[model samples]
Target: MKRRTTERKMTDKERKFLVELLACTPSKFKRWMEGAQNALVLWAASMLGMVLGWLILAWLIHLLVNLEVGMRSPYALGVVSLLAPVCGLYAICSSVQWVRNWPDPSEALRQDISGGKVLDETYNVIEAKRFKEPEHGGLIYFLRMDDDRVLVIYDHESIALEMEGENALSSSFEPRRELHIVRAPSTEYILEQEFSGEKLELSAPVDLTVPPDQWPEQESWCEIPWLELERRLGMPGF
Candidate 1:
């Protein structure tokens, strides 16, 4: 006999939140690097093997033919010397790309938690509209409180929020996406939230510490083009 399992459907609010989260896309560098990550690794390995194979073949050619004569000829030596560095450089590049594309530990954990139900503690009730740029294809929740700092949050597959100049917090929202914390940003030191899995991980790095109190008050901040912000921050564009 097989065990029976009952699955409940998500409520309307949950479904809407999920749709928004699913629409957000990762940075361009991530897309490019992850596109052929596995294939790139194999290519790098094959190229290294080819280099070793060529070295062995050169030795055999020297033994079987007038290899000393070829080595003595400046033209033959020049061709060999030129090709060696080119092949070496290509191999080095491919290897670096493979490592750079490796998955982040924090991101991997977030994906895992997405399978479970989102805890009730995630939602923040304030109606303050954070940066809402429909053209950018996403909206971020920006907030300011008692302290001289700002809180920026957004919903992806997981809940990603950061306190400028402080630390970031990311949690899986299997059932819902919300910010439950009410405390304002700290003025003296950075505040952080730690999970059993790993620290906060984001597509782009941000320094909330500098000008930590500069929270966007007017809707004008939303008007600033998304690509422009990405460019200014030295982050990958769409």
Candidate 2:
């Protein structure tokens, strides 16, 4: 019996998509380093807090019990002081290992889109819109691809509101694509979509600088010109 292989060949468009996805790595990596630094700093602070808390606790116990030699407090403090650094070192090592094992931007993007039930063939980006949120200080790219597919890339601190009543928080790099979706916007814009005759509200109203175009057929679509979108995002036109 021959073994069946499940591997599917990538289309040329998919290859291009991968290239575009790879272009996001520098931004993704910078955010990843910043996160790792923040985590290490937080871990150090927590370890210090633990040591100080133990000292305070030990001192309080000593005061309450009225021990004579004061040996117990010193011993306990010594043990904690020794164990804290070990635990901190272990945490650092674990974090480093995890970082080493983390996936690159392209693979991560594939996972995100696949998890969202988007077919691999439609990974191509036909048109793209980019934006930046002043308050959040993050770059947002809206990719309008084939088959009514939309890929929303949230870089760094940018985020989006879910169709459900929940916050769709983004990590260092997130690629969100959904089927039968006409428009995808960041938290900064108010947009709506109708699927199966049911209307879906996406975001709340904001002071949008990009005015909506009058599309006689598809009024729901936020049709921002490609050149203008790039300009507004502070990126040179492709």
Best by TM-score: 2
- After superposition, the stretches of candidate 1 with alpha carbons farther than 4 Å from their true spots are 1-84, 90-94, 97-101, 105-141, 145-238
Model 2 worst lDDT window (10 residues): 183-192
88-178 per-residue lDDT for model 2 (tens digits): 7766776676666664445555553353322212233344444544344344555564544444444433443333333323333323332
What TM-score, computed on C-alpha atoms, does each candidate reach?
0.26, 0.35
Instruction: Give the poorly placed runs of model 2, Cα more than 4 Å off.
Output: 1-18, 26-39, 68-77, 97-238
The CA lDDT at 212 in model 2 is 31
Compared with the true structure, what per-residue lDDT tens digits does model 1 show for residues 15-123?
4444344455454566556545644555556656665676666668779994643444455566566656665567557656755664333343334235332322123
Model 1 C-alpha lDDT versus the unseen true structure: 0.37
lDDT: which candidate is best?
Answer: 2
Q: Which pairs of residues collide in model 1? A: 118-175, 122-178, 122-179, 123-178, 123-179, 124-179, 164-208, 165-208, 165-209
| Residue 78, model 2, lDDT | 69
TM-score of 2: 0.35
